[model samples]
Target chain A: MSETNSPSPMRILYIEDNPLIAFHVEQMIEDLGHVFAGSLDSFAELQKQFASLEMDGALVDIDLADGATGPQAAAWLQERGIPAIFVTGQRQVAAEHGDVSLGTITKPVSSSELAAKLELFR
Target chain B: MNTIEDKSLPALDQVLILAPYRKDADYLGRLLAEHEINVRAGARIDDLARMLHPSPGVLVATHEALTPDALATVAAHLETQPSWAEMPIVVLLDRASRPDQVRAELGRVWPRARLLFYQRPVTAVELVSGVQSALLVRLRQRDVRDHIAQEVELRRELNHRVKNILASVTSIFEMTRRGATSIDAFADDFRGRLGALDKVHSAVFHSEGDTVSIAEIAELTFDPYRLSGMDRIVANGPPVTLSREAGTTLALCLHELTTNAIKYGALSHPDGRVQFAWNLSQDETPELAISWKESGGPDVEEPSRAGYGTRYVRSALAGMFGQKPVIAFEADGLRCEARGVFSRVAGNQ
Candidate 1:
């Protein structure tokens, strides 16, 4: 069992659309000592990283650039055995797709929640 | 409801950073890894969504990472989505000390976006704080929306149950009236009662549970026999919706007249017919006059005793119109006329 307070080093790929949220979440990821595999906002960019990078888990948002949503991104990451968390500001979208097993962090993600979700990958 | 904690951060995993702009993307990734975030770098936004596994908890994107058209596309999708969707964006802005400039830019492209404006050369802590704050807001918003959805669903269930109860009551009325003595004679009486209820229901339905329509009373009263091809049953009136009680009363009055016609007046014969017309008489006074005339029926005379139908008609119409209806049993046919005051509904007037 992963402790919520002690998150282990894990590779993460983040896909979000808001800059301020990305900046804050990125800071929290580092503050907690987690490794960020990559951050993306579009499907095409995510695809490129999948071809090359090794990742432990992923955090995705449903809305993204280039007409790519977080679910589409999570699907790709799931195929690679990379655990993905949805960091979203929209609760309806989260609950609508809540049946999925992946972790979901509502936006304005705190360092604590991000760390807690990242611990699942460990 | 869950809060992000400092102890949860981890390090040592390889991270691949992906962003459109070189300076901000590399800076964000390095800043995370430096805090022991364990990060790698990716080249573009599309590759990050498609290829990255166990997707990253935080995605960092600058204006340069996507074309303006692409950002616009993302914005459009966001509009349809709930408030907590974590599509976080960290727009790398030129360092401007003034708040007015920042506000102006916020009004421009980031109007409703959950964004953090990072002036050039953002520090590691500031970047981390910005990202965490944005994500935190997303979490709070999610909780609120969930609460609202639950409440909406409950209200709809309540509405459904209420409709079921009313339907059950209607069934009882139908069943009880069917078993009464003199079923053929009771048919007209039963229909009149049912018509009264229908008139009330129609009035209430329009106000969404508040008022009714006078025009509905006219329609409901005449609707049943409209297909009978009786040219004498003519109706001419201006349209107006009334209160629920008012509509029911008027409907009953009309029902009584029609029943009388079928049994003893104009409608009892092949050539007999009834002419009905009503209109608002004065703008300032706000009164209405409705006339009903029957022609071509057997010669008529006053009955020995006024029945329940007559009393019902008089009471119901008088209450709504503020006066008893003028009723005449002529030798050739029966004619009835009524006058009353009515107010216009707010929106219709």
Candidate 2:
């Protein structure tokens, strides 16, 4: 809550297939004192749309609507200077491709976890 | 380094022969070949490491081939064998060679190897049968290896699915809590949402192709009212299969709509009615459109503040359809309609 008063909110994009998860995390990003950059359901969407999306960072899920393309998407985002952290239940898979992500916040993400992890962007 | 994660295993069909004497190597290779066995008469010890890549099913070694260097190489291969592997080694010794001494020493040298000893005058039948038995053992090991791989894959998939379900439930819980006005309201809302999620999940699981049809979702969502002899709400639609994810989202939306109707919209009053209908377009890229209409209810009014049901339906429908839906609060009742590409959410069909 230290950042609540002087909330330097980050516009965080969520790349997840499940709308409910995306919505929940979107609200958490806002509650944790960050901005929601919006969401995309697949890596293909991110490829086509990243140029227009204004985001400081991203929370990516391992599985998306297309397939298990989250790691590749993270690497692509990294090349564009947009840092990403994995928001996944498959932490081992996320860890295997650790070079691309800042870190991972496991699913069923708590508000506290989102707050601390979002600070890494600053 | 091969573990349970190895996508493919080395073909263990060849019997590798280690014999320093050219005569012995040729004789053994020819004999094994005559028995319809694949034999690689590896003369030089230097090439043994490369040959081990596609690992041999059995190792046939003569007494003269047990040089310190040869033993060391074989020992190293044994050391690196995967947990399921136990390479069979048949050592042909001199007539006077004491079998116990050779077995004991080789046992210490290659602890993981299954060793068989034979005298120099052994018959072709004896040798072939022994090698065949060893090959059979190797085949069993490969089966074990495959089983382990399958188990590992199944466990990982199960873990991923369980985590996904937990994440989904947590999302529902948090969102429900946010919309909840009191503890009692929270419990009711949460339980209702969970029940809807569970029912849809069960339908998808029971159905072929991991899909749930639009009609099935409608039947499940409106079953409570229909059972109560409430003729106010009706679901009418052609058979349209939806992918599990799409089915789940739609089911939840229906739940929200159904609950709202029961509370304040249509089904709350005897005269009020709700029409839930869907259609598939006949275009090249077919689209699925669903509409919810409520009528004859108390004077319709847009809420001063949109609650969870309204917000969820709007956002979720937009996500599914790639277009915003029109949710109008007419003077008579509430109306919601959305249209989207059917291909985007179609099941196996």
Candidate 3:
């Protein structure tokens, strides 16, 4: 709530497969004053990165390459005490999260909204 | 200048105008005149319901005097509206009002609507911002719903087109085959080939537009003979998936083998039986083994002419195996053993 108590810059692992969105989100992460660990498309690659990389938070797309969605990835991160945000194309899916407090930004995500969401990771 | 629109707007169409007093509706009406939005003074409870159509776009219900009956009526109408409506109903409660009274006033309707509560007397900036937020959410929901509907319809259309194309191709092949040979002979050959292709297509379709399941391909290969009661076929393999190309090739090969069996092998007589089994081989060659053994037909002999079906079977097996299938027509019955490479093409976990 206070500026002096704000956490350090978050290290974000953004998992998205769409070429256009991935490109824009990667740029937006840097513009928002955070470190982009990397962007991954495959579940196998994501798992490997999670095991090896030290990330403070994650932004995942619900629908991913090879039928793996963001919810499963988010659950994994949450279990490890790392917060995650979902960037989804569909708002209906967004509404279905009745109680799940993890933030969601329905696509197409703007730079300001992305910054506002990622700020919570701190 | 003082009149409301005579006709109703289309269903799912919404208009929002905030009036500090009743006279402001007229000014707001002229401001939004070109947009053709419906504007009215003091909506009754029943008027709200009557105005609602199958599709809901937006509604702006602002409190006039917050009378007991009027407040209850708006509250009741809000409870009846659909959740997706994203209606912006502004309540003009005094900013310095008692908490208990405000709570009681809003409690009746707040539970239903995704509302933006604005304390009145309200300003233009606050009113416009509240209305804009609600309208933006409503428009977004509409776009997603429409896009999903279009996507589902397109998929169905593509599926229907695929079926039509396959059917026309079958007819063309039949017509060409008929012109080349005697009618009955051509019909029989064409039907057999078509049956093989249809089996593959059926397997593909049941797979939800992906590659055919190995389980499905096996059932298609043996289903007809199983019904006849002369031949009993058993299938066994790991959970394997096959591409459209591979499934069709296997279906055609199985048809050739089954036809030969029915004509001269175990299926030719009631006393005989044929067993068909396939499994991924252990050599790590990524290959599948389909072994067909015949038990009872009259003494078998290799035919003089390698017919069109035989050529197709040989070529298909050759392409799959890098060698011809082992075909032995012995004195007892005919035994065919084919090995084909396996590739998991779709619906893989």
Q: How many clashes show up per model?
A: 103, 0, 4
Query: How good is model 2 by TM-score?
Result: 0.79
Please list the C-alpha lDDT of all candidates, in the order they appear.
Answer: 0.60, 0.88, 0.61
What tens-digit string does per-residue lDDT give for candidate 1 at B176-225?
A: 34334577756756666666666666566777754655566666677778
Candidate 2 vs 3: which has more DockQ: 2
Between candidates 1 and 3, name the one with more favorable lDDT. 3
Show model 2 residue runs off by greater than 4 Å.
A1-12, A28-37, A50-122, B1-8, B27-39, B93-101, B104-108, B117-126, B206-210, B230-233, B236-239, B271-273, B279-284, B295-297
lDDT of 2 by residue, B88-183 (tens): 999999999888898899999989999999998999899889998999999888888778888888798789777777888988999999888899
Which digits, one per residue and each the tens of the lDDT, describe model 3 over residues B20-97? 466656554454443444444444443444544333455554455455654565556666654444445555456676
Chain B TM-score against the true chain B, each candidate: 0.49, 0.83, 0.53
DockQ, cand. 1? 0.01
- Candidate 1, residue B184: the lDDT equals 71
Off by over 4 Å in 1: A1-122, B1-181, B199-216, B344-349
After aligning candidate 3 to the native by TM-score, how far in Å is the CA of B35 from where it should be?
29
Among the numbered candidates, top DockQ falls to: 2
